[model samples]
Every structure is written in C-alpha cells, then in structure tokens.
Target: MGVVADRVVSILLANGVMGMRLWFGQVRWVYRQRRVWVLPAVIVLGAVALSWLVPYLDRRWAEELTRLPTGEFAGTFDASVMATVLSAVASGTIAFSGFVFSVVLLVIQFGTGTLSARMAPRLTQDWVVGAALGTFMATFVYTLLVSLRLGARVEDYQPVLSSLLAIGLALASVALFFTLLTRVINFLRLVKVLESVSRAGARRAAEVHPYPLGSQGDTDVDLGPPDRVVRHAGRAGVLLGFDEEVIAELAARAGCVVVAVPAIGDFVLPGAPLFEIHGGTSLAERRLRRHVVFGIERVVDADPAFALRVMVDIAIKALSPAVNDPTTAVQALDHIGALLLNLSGRELGITHIRDRAGAVRLIHRCSDWTDYLSLGVDEIRYYGRDSIQVIRRLRALYLDLLRSCPSERLAPVRDRIAAVDDDSAAFSTAFDRAVATSPDWQGLGGPAPIDDRQC
Candidate 1:
C-alpha cells in the first residue's frame, strides 16, 4: 500500500508540473511575445461586469445622492446629467482610443525605420502601454453599458455613483493617453531606446552573474564524462529559461549534472541535444524538456547576450552601405561602452546552478567580456571602415573599456585598437587618415579639435 501511494503521488506531481509548462507556454505566447491585446480584452470584460454591478451598487448604497435637493445639487446625478456624462465618456473614449492607436502605429513605423527593426517587434511587451490601451477601450465599453440602463421618464433612476465612476475613468484615460504619447516618443528617439535596452540588459546581466564574495566552495563544475544526451522535443524556438528547482529534483533523483547544451537565446533546432547528463548513464528527455522554456524572442531574465544581440543588430544595420548612417552606429557604441564598463568588473561565464543538497544540478553557458566586445563592436568597426566618426567612437570605447577592464583583458582591447589603426592606414592620404585618427565626439557634423595626445 505504501508503494502504491508513492507511485500515485509521483503520477500526480508529474501531471501537475506538466500542466504548469502548458500554462507557461500560453503566457509566453499571449503576453510574452508581441501580442499586446490580452490585457485589453480582460479589462473590457471586467468593465462590462462592473457596468451591471455599479447601478445596483449605487441604488443599494447611494440613494441619498440621488435624492439630494435640486437647488443645492443642480449638477448631481440627475437623469439628464447622467445621460450627458455617459454619452461624453463613451464618445470621447472611442475617439481617444483611435488617436492612441494612431500614435502607436506612427511610433512603430518611426522606430522600425529609424531604429533597429529587430527591437521594434518587442515594443508590445511594454505593459504600461498595454494597460493604457486597455483602459481606454474598457472605459469606452463601460460608458456604453451604463448608458443602456437610462430611462426616459423623470421618475426613473439616475446612477450617480456609476456616472461619477465613468467621469473618473475618463479623466484617468486622458492622463494615460498623454502618458502613452510620452512613452511612445521616448521609444521613438533612437538614443533613448538604445540606452533603455542597454541599461535593462546590463541590470539583468549583473543580477544573473553577480561577483562572488571570496570563493564559492564545493561547486563541482568539472563533471568528468557525459554519459548521456537529451535532444530537443516538439517545435524549435529560442531557449528562454530553465526551472532550476524542478530540474534540481530530477538531477537529484538521477544523480547527475544536467548541462544545457545550447546557450539561452540560442535557436534550438529540432533534434538538437538540449542537455548532456554528466556522470549518469540514463537521461529523461521528456521530463527535462518541460522545465526548459522556449519562446519566439530572447528575454532578459537570464540572457545577457539578447541585449548585445539587439545592440549589434542596430549597429550593423546602420553601417550598411544603403543606410551609411555612421552617427547612429557611434551612438550605439556609447551605450555599449557603458554596458561593457558595467560588465568588466563583474563575474561572467557563471554557469553553475546548485540543487537543494548543495549539489550542482544545471549548467548554463553565456558570453564573457571578449564575446561581448566582439558582438558589440567588431562587426560595426569592420563594416564602418570609411566612416571616420565610427572609428573615433570605437577608439573612445576601447580607451574607456581599457581603463575599467582588468590587466589580463587589456591585450584583446589593444589588439582591436591596432586593427583600427590598420584599417585607417588603408586611406592613402595623411589628411584623410588624420580625419579617422581622432575620436570625433561631434561625428560628421561639427568636428572637434584633434586630441593628438590620445592618438
């Protein structure tokens, strides 16, 4: 009976855990990706329910407001006053919704054309904007519902509280509408967007890969031989995160270290080895995959490189011959430099995840300083060969990074500087080389005097 009970508990746990995986998948699809309408749908439904409840609630609670003397409370919840307010809220909100959507569409176009196209797709994940949009739609719906309860007869009831609530929502919607415009404008500005994305990435990177105080003892990172491999299942997507606690249970039972074969944000192809169980002879592909989440885009939760990916994409696109927008590339380098400065002093390539018994359960691979430097600047430095502003920004970046980086990491940055020198040397004339020789703070527009000391 004990054995049977144990088996039953295991089955229930398995089913419950798998259900969590399914729920997470849906969440990632509806809210995690670019689908921004889910919150609005929920808000509208709630508003409809509240529309019915508000009138009943007012009649039950606020009959005194309805019965106030007309001389003292001329503008109170009279039938005409209620009708006018409801009609105004409904029409004003509908118009406001249209205007807000138009602004969003315009901003999307501006961001896609001016900023990184890759970054533009994730704008919907900004739930502040989502909630704003949802409020406008919900308020419109609420007013319409409340307007239906009105009667033509003077003796009929007028919903004072409901009309007052509608007025408040309308006011809130107006504020949010303007707030949305401000947010959209900030997002539209290329520098602001780059800074925001870079800062978010840096903050997340620091959280996930913080510097260890003294030493982290007894971390057995060197599990000898991989005895088994677990391949990917179902459809392919970017590996977003892992349920470390759940995986720890599986690893404890199996008595092996589960190494995530693909880095987070990496595109996992079908049949690719997702995990390598070191020091164990068996692997459970189905059970393990449930804890490994995948999504259409990279999330910053654990993936630092996703931010780097976005920065590089923008720089590369700006450096394209068709765009020839070197200033934009330089602007990207400014934020990238700050991120690198933040990363230079922190611990990186932090791959170990420990279980309940303080045993290593999972390994997550990630990029370090060299990798970030390459991803952030190498392609742009190579692509923007003819652009003097790009080269100078690259110089400034290296100089700043070199000061912050440790002694061992200095050589690679210097090597990049040498490469910059070699690229500028390709220009035959001394004058043209001088143009590329200095860091141009002003870029192509108004040139700053050459600081030959640094050169």
Candidate 2:
C-alpha cells in the first residue's frame, strides 16, 4: 500500500509541474502579443515603489550631508521652491507623455496606410515607443509623489536626493523622446521597414531550419493509419507551436507514433483532430493538449512563413493601381530574395522526432522550399506583370536563384522563370516584352549580358 501511495504521489507531483509549465507558456504567449502596455505598467509601479524608498534615503542622507564640507554644493532648495519645481516637472512630463502617444498613433496610421497593414502590430509592439512612454510616465509619477510628500510636512524638510533624482529622470525622458522621434521617422521609410522584416524572417528561418539541406539522413518510417485520434478540447485558437520534446516523450512512453494534424500557424477549432496516435496504448487527451500552444494570432517566432507573407503583402500593395509604385515593389522583392537566399541553404519539410531506441515518435509538418519560393515570388509576378521594372527584377531574382540554389531546387526556379516569361508575353509592345523578359539586377538601367538577350 505504501509503494502504491508513493507512485500516486509522484504522478500527482508530475502533473502539478506540467500544469504550472502550461500555465506559464500561455501567459508568455499572451504577453508577447499584448506587451505594449506591460513595460509602461511595470515602470510606473517601480516609480511608485521608488517614491517611498527615495524619500526614506533622502532623510537619512540629509542628516549626514549637513556634516560634510561639500554639503553647500548639494544645491539645497527651500521646500516651497522645490515643490514648485516638482509640480512644473510633473505637468511638463504629463504633457510630454500625451505628445508621445499622439506621435505613436500617427506612426501607426501612416505605417498601415502607406506601407502594409500587417506592420500595425509591429509598430504597436515597438520597444522604443513603450520605453519612451514608460519613462515619461515614471517621471511624472515620481515628481507628483515627491511634491505631495513635501506639501504634507509642516517643517521645511527639503528632499535633496529625491529632487536630484527627479531632475535626472526628467533629463532622461527628454533624451528618450528624441530617440523615439528618430525611430518613428525610420519606421516610416520603406527600405528600413523591408530590412527590418527581412532580418526577422532570416533569424526565424535560421532557428527553424538550422542545418544545411539534406544534412540529416531521412529515414522512412511507415506508421500506417492511426489507431486513435486526439482532438482539441479547448477554445478555438491559432496553433502557435508545440513542445516537441514533451510530445515525443509522451509518444515514446505510450509506444506509439504521433502525427500532428495541423501545422504551426493553423487555426484549430474545438473538436478538431489535433493528433493521430498510431499503434500505442491510450494516452490522456489533456496531456497531449497541454503541450501544444495556441494564441489569438500567428506570430513570427514560430511561423517562418509569416515574414515572407508580410513582405509579399508590402510588395503587392505597392503594385496596386492606387499606389502604382513599381519601384517600391522591386525593393520589396530585394528583401524577399535575400530571405529566399537564406532559406535556400537550410533544411525544410516534415520533421521526425526520434526516441532513445531510434523509433519515430513524433511527426510534424514544416514549410518546404517550394512553398517559400512560390510565396515570395508569385504574387508580385501576377500583380506587376505589366510593369517593366517589376518584371525585370523578377527575372533577375529567378536567374539569381537558379545560379545560387542547389541542383535539386533548380526545377522550381525554372518553373518560376517560365511563369515570368508568360507574364512578359502579356506586355503590349515587343520592346516592352523584350525588356521585361530580360534580367536586370538593378531592376532597370542595369547592364545585361550581350549574349543572353534571347527573349
């Protein structure tokens, strides 16, 4: 009976730990999505705590400072004068914070309308905007508290330390305000935005596909039709990601192969099939569901394709009739090509998780090369078909990929090149068709090889 009780306690403890982990993961996912307010809230709280501590320290230090020779240099101000200064600082900072909020709103408006609406979330989540707002608010709170403390005292007890610290924070707020303006201006630029998205996409691609293509040997594990299916039991949400190690461990213990039905970034409704368990003892549905994370919207942290999707959105938006900005479309393709180049050398497709005994325990789908290639190129080709500059840039991008990508990847590149030719054929004039079909690395007015002008 003691042994059974001990085993039961251990299982309970394991479940407790897993529960905590799942709860923490959900909180983190929500925080990342809605983190704009978190930093400012934390900073304001810190200021409130500091308001009490700084006055306490100031009282202690004031007593000691009077005994020092340099006490006169500490810039003592009367209580009334210090109160006025603190009030002024408080009023100015609150006004500054309002201005900062206005600027951020304008940035969001301009960025979404002029650039792509996808960038709205990114703009809102920017740390610069959050930090600037937090600093301004912290300064206001600290000064207001200090002033209130001074007013409540009958004796003229000047908080020299608190006054100096408030001034320092005010100065820091000014500096950050300027920095925020600079960042807002940079965000409005098209090239800067493209570079930012491309860099993020490259980082995610590196994380998702760390190894060179074909570096790991592919093993054929035929796990036929599933013996049982595990369906989602929670509210409907987008599948953000899953803990592979945990799922693999669960599958290994059950002596089964688990295949994920929905890929990361897929929206799974309640009662949808989440996993298919093949040839194993029955596992708890709660255990399987806990390991998979869900969120309101897909994020780039797990979805490598999201970056490409954003850049493509920017490109096609530029190519729209109202925008009619083929140059901007070409620039978007520049970054898209860079992201593709980064992915070209990496491993992609179905991922297999193995147990200690080398048995395939978990199988999950990943975006492969062709998916990425089509995503990065097809929309721009279709939208900008008549624009000579866009077509030339597309031709250049395809030819560049043909030369750089591995032999196994060449077929897709050729197919895209053929598609570009078909697009070019729609040009109204022969001269326009010829120029559009030819590759120009600069998109236009760049040297083309004399012998390579077959089109």
Candidate 3:
C-alpha cells in the first residue's frame, strides 16, 4: 500500500513539474513568434480602461480644463457635437480596421505565392501590422465608449479630455495606416524579403551556435547501450526545440546521460524513439517529453537550420521551370551565402551539455558546417544548371566562401567549387562552359579571371 502511495505521489510530482515547464515553453514560443494578438489585446484592454477613467477625470477637472489653452480648443465641441464627432470617429476607424484586415489578407496571399510559403508566418506576425490594427481597434473602442458616455448629458458636460484623446487616437490611427502601407509595400519587394529572411537566419545562427569554430573541446561521451529508450507518445509534430538545461538537470538528478534521438526541426511521430537513457536510473518519460517542445511547423527561434531551409526553398522555387527566374535564384544565393558566412565562424554539430558537476548529462544533434553548405548550395546548383547567371553566381559564391571560411571548413567549399566546374563542363559549347565556369560576383557583366576565361 505504501509503495503504491509513493508511486502515486511521484507521478503527481512529475506531472506538476511537466505542466510548469510546458507553460514556460509556450510563453517562450509566443514571445519568440511575436504573436499578433498580444499587442492588440493589450491595446484594446487599455482603451477600455482609459475610456472609463478619462471620462471620470474629465468631469472632475472640467472647469480647470476649460481654463487651459488646449482644453479651450477641446471645449469648442458641445455635447451633441462631441457625440457626433465620436460617432464619426468610431464608424470610420472600424471601417478602417476592416480595410486593414482585407489588405493584410491580400498581402499575405500575394507574399505566400511569390515568396516561400514558410514566410507566411513572418508576414502575418509583422509587428507593424499588429500595431496598425491595434491602434485602429483602440481608437474605435475608445471613441465608442466615450460617445456612449455622452448619453442624456447636459450641453455643458462635454468630456473635453476624452474628446481630445479620441481625436488624437484617430489621428494616430491615420498615421499608422500610412506607416503600415509603406511597410507592406517594402515587404512585397523580393530583395526585402530575402534580406529579412537572411537577417533572421543570421540572428538564429548566432544564438544557437554562439561558440566560434574550434572553440569548444570534443563533445563526445561514451555511454554503453541504453538501459531504456523512451518513445514519444504524443501526436506527431516537428520537434521545435528542447530545453537543454532542464533536460540536463533531470539527467543529472537521475545520474544518467540522456541522448536525444531526433534533431530539432525533425518531424517526430507517435511511437518514435525520443530519448536513449544510458547508465542512469530510469526517468519519468513524461518529464523527458515535457522539456522538448513540438509544433506543427518548425520555427527559426530555435532551429538555426530552418532559415537556410527557407532560403533554399525560395531559391529552388524560383529556379523551377515554370518560374525559370535565375536572377531570383542568384539573389537567394546571395543571402544564403551571407548566412553561411556568418555561420562559418560558429561552432556547430552534436552538442554535449553537462551539469554542475561537469558530467555530461545530455546529447543532442545540431547542424554541422557540411550540412549547411549542402543545404545552401546543392538544390540551387542542380535546378539552375542550365542558367549561366546562376552558374556564374554559384562559382563566385564558392570562391568567396573559399576565401573567407575557416581552414578546417575549406574542404566543403572546395568540393562545391569542383562540383560547379563539373556542372559547367556539361555545357554544350566551350565558350558557354568557360563563361559558366568563370566566377562573376555580379553573376554577369563583371570581369572574370583571365585564367578562368582561358579555361
């Protein structure tokens, strides 16, 4: 009986810990994604609270407000006129809000079609869009509430402060509308989209792989065959990320090394092997699973490879026969190259996380330099093989990377250059092959090396 009771207590404790970790993980995801609802929700609630507080304050300080210069201007509107103006503001702003939503949907549709579908989330979660919608909604809510407050009021009982605030909000909404429009226009540009994705990739790469190449010592730790393998029991989804600290702490407590079976961003299914617990007392499977977050789609916040994945998707899509836009492919490579350059200096590959006693507690796979190079170069090279612009740009990219990447990382870059040469050799004519093989940073119209031209 006592043993059963202890088991029940242990299960309850594990569940409680898992619940807290999941909650914190969700909060982090929301923050990283910058969900659109957060700002608007705050703005709408503030409007509701201010709508009540401002009217009361206005009534109390009505006489003193009239003495102020700005308040004198605010007092020009009688109660009926104030109500009319608020009514107009309320109706106009709500209409504006609807229009903004319509425009957002259209923009998202166009962007998803033109850019990679992975970009849809970035478009939808844009803070500018959120700010514009929030401002418009706040204006509508504030004006409507203040207008309701003017009901059955005497002519002298004008909410001067509230009236002024409503007008200010309306004006602010108009300004934000223009700002949002400009942002949308800029976002629609291909270059801007590439730049945005590249920047996001660079940021995530720096975050995930903070140590420079060769900075960390060997991460290998030998633990014999696992005594127990934990299989996932949840619905299938992409492994968004895991909390190394939490997992490491749990492993340390259990006197074990936990080996993660699937890398971040890998699609995991129910019954898939999730962890290999070697040399430790068994851990609660629920506890292990809770520290790892899963989502229907992978996000860049935790997966450094995702950004490269997105760029490669864009590049290959542009290179498709229907599109046959080699220039776009080159542009995509430009950013891909930039991201790789940033990553070239970073330490990558399987990481071994340790606990306070310096014992290896967790093992997880990470994208290595070779994986990134392949992801960034392989597909574009194949699809763009027939396009001279793409060939030349790829040659230049390889040369640039070879010149800049670390000595230890040079083999992959050299191999890519050789691959480009081999692909160029497949051209029908010598002149075509030479130009294709020539490294031109501009993809064309730039001076090629004399030796390259001769070749």
Best by TM-score: 2
RMSD (Cα, Å) for all candidates, in order, is 8.0, 7.5, 8.3
> lDDT by residue for model 3 over 1-455, one digit each (tens)?
98896575455434433543454465366445566788888889999999999888888887887776764565486787788889898998898789788988999898878778998887677777888888899999999988888865645465778888897898888899888888788778988888877887776675566556764556668678988999989999888777776998999988889999998889999999999999777578899887777777876655668888888888889889888788888888899999999999987898776676557788888989999999999999998888999999998888778779889999988888888888898999999987786778778898876666322
Kindly list the per-residue Cα lDDT of model 2 for residues 6-84, writing each as its tens digit.
Answer: 5754554344335434533643564464667888888899999999998888777776755646547355667777888
TM, every model: 0.83, 0.88, 0.86
- Comparing 2 with 3 on TM-score, the higher-scoring candidate is 2
Whole-model lDDT per candidate: 0.73, 0.81, 0.81
Off by over 4 Å in 1: 1-34, 67-75, 151-156, 212-228, 279-287, 300-302, 356-358, 440-455
Clashing pairs in 3: none
Candidate 3: minimum summed lDDT over ten consecutive residues — where?
A: 12-21
Candidate 1, residues 99-135, lDDT tens digits: the string is 7788788888778776676666556567778888888
lDDT-better candidate, 1 vs 2: 2
Clashing residue pairs, backbone N/CA/C < 3 A, model 1? none
Model 2 poorest 10 in a row by lDDT: 12-21
